[model samples]
Target chain A: MALEKQSRAAFWVTVLPPTLWIAVFFLIPLGIVWAYSFGHNEGLTGVAITGTFDNYIRAFDPLYLQIFGKSIAVAGLTTLLCLIIGFPVALAIVFANEKMRPLLLLLVMLPFWTNLLIRTYALIAVLRTEGFANWTLAWFWNQGSTLAALVGLQPFPAYQPLELLYNNFAVVVGLVYVHLPFMVLPLYAALDRLDKSLMEASLDLGAGHLRTLFSIVVPLALPGIVSGVIITFVPALGAYLTPDLLGGTDSQMIANVIERQFKRANDWPFGAALSFLLMYATFAAIALRAYLTRGQPADGHGI
Target chain B: MDQLAQRTQDAAAHKPIISFRNIVKRFGSMTAVDNVSLDIMPGEFFALLGPSGCGKTTLLRMLAGFEVPTEGSVLIDGQDMGETPPNKRPVNMVFQSYAVFPHMNVADNVAYGLKIDGLPKDEIKARVQEALDLVQLGPLAARKPDQLSGGQRQRVALARALIKRPKVLLLDEPLSALDAKLREAMRFELSQLQQKVGITFIMVTHDQDEALAIASRIAVMHKGAIAQLGTPSDLYEFPASRFVADFIGSVNMFEGTLIKDGADEAVIACPDLAPYSVHLPHSAPGSAGASVWVAIRPEKLNLHKNASEPPAVPDCPPAHNVARGEIKEISYLGDSSIFHVQLSSGQLLRVSRPNRSRYEQEHFGWGDTVWVSWAGSSPVVLLS
Candidate 1:
């Protein structure tokens, strides 16, 4: 009995610290959010302790539903664009000459070394109405108008420049640029581990280049592409800084709405409900990804 | 099968199936394959035998269309394959690793080439079944490569390569991955399969035993060049140079100077062994004052006790090659004994003798004085 007690003490001593840390940091915050989602909102001051489902019902309101739909659209677009530009670049990097591969990989990751916020702001500097793009447009218009006037014809009607800042297009561009490396790095690693003999076997068996790529390369690389999509899509869905700096009310995402409810409207309970909905959506997306990729063997497991 | 053999016979009657005319392959500053000219007859089992990095695989790859020669050209069926890509070539290769597709089953793997050619589904199925049956793998048609044993995977690779019905089949060390027993079994199986298919078989291997067992003609490669090309027995009996003599099998080489030359024989005084005369078709160049080497196989030297009378010499001449030595060590293999004998000049010579009986009845222990002798025409004289 004494020896059994001593062994039990040793086991608990080894596991207690990490268990306590997880409970305090992760479980406690999740419990607070779950509790707040069920409480009632007070009159513009704070939340009341009365248990209710009113906040959950209000989360599905049409106005908020529109923001949810728009968020999905923007994130989906970002994922699609990243895949289009990243797959080829990753393939080039993985199969390049040994001496050039490291240099190419460094070039791909160069943007991440700088401050991410500074990189996003740099996009604003380039795409703003008075930025380099507009300057070039203005110069083209001036040249065309001068040539028309010189030919003894009336110049084209003057047009005002359009605003590009505070829009959904700028937000999408920022998300794609920020998340592209995430997509490319995983893809490069996956392609690097693929056996070269598999491709040769396919070719020797008389499959053309396109058939080999579609039937063999794509199926083998599906797991990597799925992971890349998840990495780019989940973060873009809940993005706050990009939408806030480069989007107006027309482009407000669920994250921005939650922020408004907490800081501006003083409705902490409703904000907490909205946060729970976002969390549930992210969880559902992850479960769907897992179901799709369950058949793929883990790295180094299958042939 | 008879029809295929007849077709192969007809093809051989017309022209060579594959030909390499002064082929050379260079990678940057390194020359992997020098000027190699060879012709492979149809229905013939030809082997390119060499050590590693001796350009045998590179030569095989050139024939497979995976590589193109930097100089000269490769020909299949008298048509130059200078610019033909691998996919368009009428040849297929079983890669050194087998190169079996992990995602594909045996039947699907064998049918891949026909499917790519857009054949009818029924025809593809029938041909796949036929190929699998040819390799005796019809029962395992639905299994993936990883699910099969090493020998089974090898058959699958062979089936996949042969289903295309190419003019020639290239095997790049196909049995190198099998265990010793399996490798021996597959060597015989591969030879019988080639006879059944009746297509030209070009194999590359470093194992001399494997080459001699399967190949009708063998090309010994050294330093990106063919040292000698002949039948297995021809190469074994009359190796053209010291390289071929030493590479093909175990040989005891003794450096010597030619002392006299006759019409069909020459006497050589070896610095390390007893003097010997070898019969040849032509006298050695610079016969009287030139250096030469005599190669005698270990099994050709006979070891007898000193108390026993020496065997009478043959009609050609007396026992020209004879030496007296003391047994230094004896290795008692179950069926044979390998005796390491130290001669009077302190050179150790190895002689293998059959046990022929129980160890207690017929055995040569250590530290026994022995007489070793050979006939005049036993050793081959290497001029180079």
Candidate 2:
């Protein structure tokens, strides 16, 4: 702070650009949406600031509340899945050879290079009824039936495709696929900063690799794990495209409901209210993270 | 008295606790440790002393089951540790960084090994208390490692490793991280703790003072091999090679040719001491006309400004131990002063004198002509 005070020009040069960018691009629009949440729709394109509580009251109704609850469940499950899968991926990346570490990290981040829509569509191509997944299952089934017939046993019946798309399971699969990099990158950052001699010390003290992983690695990585959970959970909770493209009748989340209010129903005020409620939940998760990492100077990586 | 005699006899007949038999370690194209063979006796405070990359730490790591020797085998307590992992080995290490678990408190850190052994909760708790009290850290058992001072954290590491009571305890540059004053204090503490535990402690250190002060035996490593292995005095006084002599402390190397190899004594004629020779009290190595080095420590030589002082030996006249030089320069250390004496042949020799007489009327300063002499046994001959 003293250095910044002395070099005021450099301080402003560094601080002004980011402050202006956030004010113009984020805060102003968010302020407008916040105002809209307190008002009601006046016409097809207009909203009046009457300070009405009707939109929030309507959001509390059981129908929308059920959607919010289901969204929370799906997002929680997705975050858990991402943690389970990303930990080994991050550990593998950390332990890779110097020449291969960057390449493996590049592979982890490759999915973000292309557009999300394109990737979702590609997932759809593989998960549809007559898609590549069913085709591979059918091929294996035919081979098994042929082998059964050659062994003089009755062959199996006709192959049936497993339901892989347009369900809550598909929504969760898509969210885990999309948000996995967020979890892995932060975990990699945290684990990479860990003092490796602690692991050696544990091993020298007669702990096996598995015990060391659970006792030493996991506790030390709590900050990263919590940050990764929040990053994955918040985005998965507000996911709109994955459910819209792949969800069934009963699989719609709160984001899908909010999208409908703004477009097909032409109710901007209620949509803004629901969006702010989701933001509030995100703020709560972030607050919880701040509380947990209060005194720890070793922050999560990539958070 | 009889029991003490019997105990000594038993110790003499006992087998070595740790032995490295011709061990060689290669990291890709680089050989880190090369055919290093040494034996550490039971309950000995052994030290592997060397500079960085001298393979001292590598050898200790191999003993701890952290690295596998590429060529030879390691045996601890007569058991071949070929397939043993670190956890199954009978040795534990206090890491150089004192790698205490940051997430766990001191008591929990000390209890980690006991928990791994599946001891009951009560036993683990009791042992943790015992270990912490052993290090005089029982009061701070609830504090985290980050909250402790550097010396306290090192004590924590010591307790954590010692709780397991492994047959051998390995320390890798243990005091290298502490401040000089703290390091000196910890040196005695570590030595006392090792004796109290009565475990065979194998420590790797680059600091010669720490090795000399704490270790019962020191192995001076040079270029992936043990240059000399003996007690600290043997290494300091009777250095086997010029490397050991130069590495352990400051020494003056007077190059000369062996002029006479006799039965009771040998003499080396140096051009720097044209009128005097280096007389070895014992018959030394080397034939006539062969070049050899006479290494003498600075503190071993006595600097005198007057010619009336008594000689070191009567009738012998300290022959070949005396040299005539003018005091060229004086470096005034706090406790002692070093006199750089320029010989008649222009060779420089340094002699250190203690600041003993505070009330002396006169002192030897620069440009004072003096005779530097030592005992006949003060010089060590190095063949290489």
Candidate 3:
């Protein structure tokens, strides 16, 4: 009995520090946020701590509903694009030659060295009308006109650079670029652990490359794909910087609205309420993913 | 089954199904398989037996179209498989790990190949059921690979591969992952299945016993080359080289110089034993005074307790090959025992004897002086 007690004491000694740290830094802060979400804020009367559901009730307003719906749509699209682009890149890295693999992975992670804000600014430079994209477009237009003249056809009209910045397109492109590594790192880990013999067996059994990829490789890597979806989608839903800088007013997301409530509008209670709504929506998405896959094998390989 | 076996044998007597002609596979600086040329007959169970890194698997992969020979051609059914992708080849493989797709149930896995060919749903289901029944996995069609035992998973792999009905089936150490008893059972089952299907089987294995039991002909490989290719008994009883003699089973070797060479017999003189005369049915490798090894299996040696006592028989000649030794150690296997005897010349020799009649008087024990004798015709003359 005494030895058991001693073991119990030792266990506490190992577990207490992290436990206390989480309680103080995470639980207490979350508790404060929860408490703030129920409070009422009256202008010119300073912040009041009276508990009410007004803030939450206002969060479901049609105006905010549209913003939340748009947020989900954009995040879903960004996640889909990241998957289509990053999955192949991760598989390529896994299949690369031994000596070149590390260099390719390093290039994938090289974007981390630059700040997200600076990267968004750089996107601005290339995406703006007078930027490198426009220059390339004008050069192509000139080449087309020269070809037309040589062919004895009518000369082409003057080149006009398309507006490629400050829209939903730019917002999604920026989000996909920013979170591609998030999608790829997990996918690379899963693909790297896959048994190469399975691929060989599939091909030897008369499955073509594409069929083997979809039937065997992708299904086996579903865990990585799911985690990549979670990592990219959840963050892109709450994205602020990319959408704020690269988006016009029509493309504003719920997070931008939440940011305004906290800083410009000085509605801390409303901001806290909006934050909880976003958390609940993200949880719902995760729960939906889990519910859809509940019948699958728990080992992450089931259909 | 007997009819199927006869039919397979008749088919094997014809032309080869797959052939590797002067095949060489090199990975940058290292040669994995050197200039190997072999023909695999249809409906024959052939094994490439070797230790790891011997390029046996590489040869199998070349036939499966996963790899192209660096210098030569791999031909299938008289067609050169040059630049042919794996899916285009008429071959299927059972992997060492079984490689059953965990995401799919057994039926789906078995039907994967058929699905790739875009077969009708009913036909796919029927073929899957038939393949599963062939492996006796029909009841487990709904079970996933992860939920099955190692042996069951192996059967699923076999079913998946065989459903394609390819011209050849490649097995990469297919039985190595199973436990010993299961491996023995599966070995017989695999050979029987090959005969029943009448498809060529090419297996790469490191276990000589597995290759001996399951293969119709075994090719023993060593260091990226074919060292010897023959039937199992031919490899065991008449090994071509010292490597084959040692690799196939335990052999005691006596290094000696050939003193007498003749058409019927040869005599080799060594310090470990008296001038050993080996009965030869064929020509010897070198003339007299050339160094060679007299290789003898341990089980062939008879251990007698008294060295000086002659047999009671007066007509028969005395033991021609005899070595006087003291029993140093004994290993008690369930059905047999191995006696390690130290000769008067201090050479340790292993002699294996069946432990028949448990209650009988003990023949030999440790510290007992004994005479190890064999027939004059038993020793194999190894040139290298």
Q: Write the per-residue lDDT of candidate 3 for residues B164-212, one digit (tens) a residue.
A: 9989999999999999999999999999999899999999999999999
- What lDDT tens digits, residue by residue, belong to model 2 across residues B271-320? 88878787776777888788999999999998766575534642243556
- The weakest ten consecutive residues by lDDT in model 1 chain B span B273-282
Residue-level lDDT tens digits of model 3 in A1-303: 999999999999999999999999999988787778999776754667678988999999999999999999999999999999999999999999999999999999999998999999999998899988888999999999999999999989999898889999889889999999999998998898888988988898888888889988988888778878988899999999999999987999989999999889888889889999999988987897787567765545534
Candidate ranking under DockQ, highest first, comes to: 3, 2, 1
Off by over 4 Å in 2: A1-6, A298-303, B1-12, B271-276, B306-319, B322-328, B342-348, B360-362, B367-369
For model 1, residues B253-293, the per-residue Cα lDDT tens digits are: 88888888777777777767654344333466556878988
Q: How well is each residue in A100-162 modelled by candidate 2, as lDDT tens digits?
A: 999999999999898999989998998989989999999999999999999999999999999
Clashing pairs in 3: none
Cα displacement (angstroms), candidate 1, residue B160, comes to: 1.5
C-alpha TM-scores of all predictions: 0.87, 0.93, 0.92
Which residue pairs show backbone clashes in model 1?
A: none
The native-contact fraction of candidate 2 is: 0.84
Q: Which sections of candidate 1 miss by over 4 Å? A: A1-23, A42-51, A130-165, A300-303, B1-13, B274-286, B307-319, B326-337, B344-346, B355-361
lDDT at residue B110 of model 3 (Cα atoms): 93
lDDT of 1 by residue, A1-303 (tens): 999999999999989999999999999988887888889776766667677888989988998888899999999999999999999988889779999999999988999899978987898887798877677788889889989999998997774566777788888888888889989988888778877666777777777778887877766777788888888889889998888888876888889999998899878888889998988888988998888888567772244
Clashes of 1: 0
